[model samples]
Target: MSSSYAGQQIAFLTQHGKEQVIAPILEPALGCVIKHVTGFDTDQLGTFTRDIRRPGSQLDAARRKARIGMELSGLSLGMASEGSFDLDPFAGMFPWNIELLVLIDDRLGIEVVGMAQGPGHSSHVQASDWPAVESFAAGVGFPDHHLVLRPQDQDDTRVHKGVSDWTGLKASFEQCLAQSGNRQVFVETDLRAFANPSRMQHIEQAAQDLLKRLQSCCPECASPGYWVSERQPGLPCSVCGRPTSGYLTEVWKCGRCLHTSVQTRTDCAFAEPKHCASCNP
Candidate 1:
């Protein structure tokens, strides 16, 4: 049950330390060598701060990044990762992080994408002065993790990012505050893969997901990237035997071919009445 890319070369485009987490997972699973493209300016395609805002949705950005790596490395296969941080989707009370890793194989004319989510994984705080920065740093798991310093009100040209030590962060904060014209320094957890351990953890999971999908083949077309794409909700309420909005089946599909299959959810055979449309109504 090996993937189609067992012996292929994959070009990974990144400046951050993505290789540390992604390489191990991909190499063992796909039996492929992950080459990092050195000179390509990935930030030109897009950035978190919207300096060079993304061309399209997250998927499009990831695909474009994959293509860029392939073109630069002269390899037909490529890989890239993108991350987004915001309020948690399932739990609105905390911050969360979402990471997506995409694999593109031009030779096969197929693309496989994987997603990972971490709730309460990222946070940001603003500090106006040196004392304020020290307090903020302790709150966001700094020193052990890194932080990014910028202007609070607007983007600053001289930003000090990837700051991990007290001396460096303090200097950056003082310098930026003096020149901010607004009297505040913006300090945030460096969400980059290398700087944030929580983010790195999620990225590793995403790599595993991509490998699993690539390993699966479509039953009908024998194409790679065959895995669960959707879920059908109709599990009967446990108490009332009425259909609920809970997922009852997992729908598998192929990236290169229009093939699909459905299976029952692994954890539960029935849904709760609290989620049942008929039972609750």
Candidate 2:
């Protein structure tokens, strides 16, 4: 247990059995006991199933969950996590997953977020026959990871989620197939933490990030979660000696007192000439 939060109890809000992964990482790292807070429908904030669209940004949703947990458990410190899936922005070819974990301390009026992103397996297949469905399942690591079934058009409200076995998947496929006017069913990997090992690993990484932030303390006010708040770009090009769109400094700020410090990258001193407009042009 770290010195700051030793022997403390933090409330974690979740409905998808996320505690199974999160608790194991956070409890030992932070030296705090995590109490799962239930009875609230976290799906109201959003869902991966597309049943209810997410209302706000991932950070906003995570903060809302943390606050709800605090209110329910009557604890000053709370934690929550949210995940989003999309195409990788840089390459725009492979599926990407962004996992965010939020820690809120009402006692200090501070909130900190830890984030992790990587390639994800979020593919979906629309098929009408059993052979195609089976092929898709095999490709997605079925039985180990779960699947969700819905109408091919993707507008239908009815969805069968958390289908792990072949028997359940076949039944769900036939049911969704009958409901679809085009006799097609949409099958996708279940993005839930417990259902997807890859997603759960990302969540664990986010928890580790949170642990690091929690361990970091502000030099000015001695508050936890002192981290980089902004990046200062404009690293000079090696050839042209002109500024490029590369980061020059990282602005670390204290979450409580807003005290800031600028630190330069230790990896490289100058940006490549290829990144400089003047050099490249």
Each candidate: RMSD: 2.0, 1.7
Per-residue CA lDDT of model 2 for 19-48, tens digit only, reads: 888888878877889999998999898888
Per lDDT, the best of the predicted structures is: 2
What's the TM for model 1?
0.92
What tens-digit string does per-residue lDDT give for candidate 1 at 137-193?
Answer: 797778867888887554666667779898898778877888786787777777777
lDDT of 1: 0.82
Clashes per candidate (backbone, < 3 Å): 0, 0
Relative to the true structure, candidate 2 has a C-alpha RMSD (angstroms) of 1.7
Model 1 misplaced regions, further than 4 Å = none
Model 2 whole-model lDDT (C-alpha atoms): 0.89
The 10-residue segment with the lowest total lDDT in model 2: 1-10
TM-score of each: 0.92, 0.94
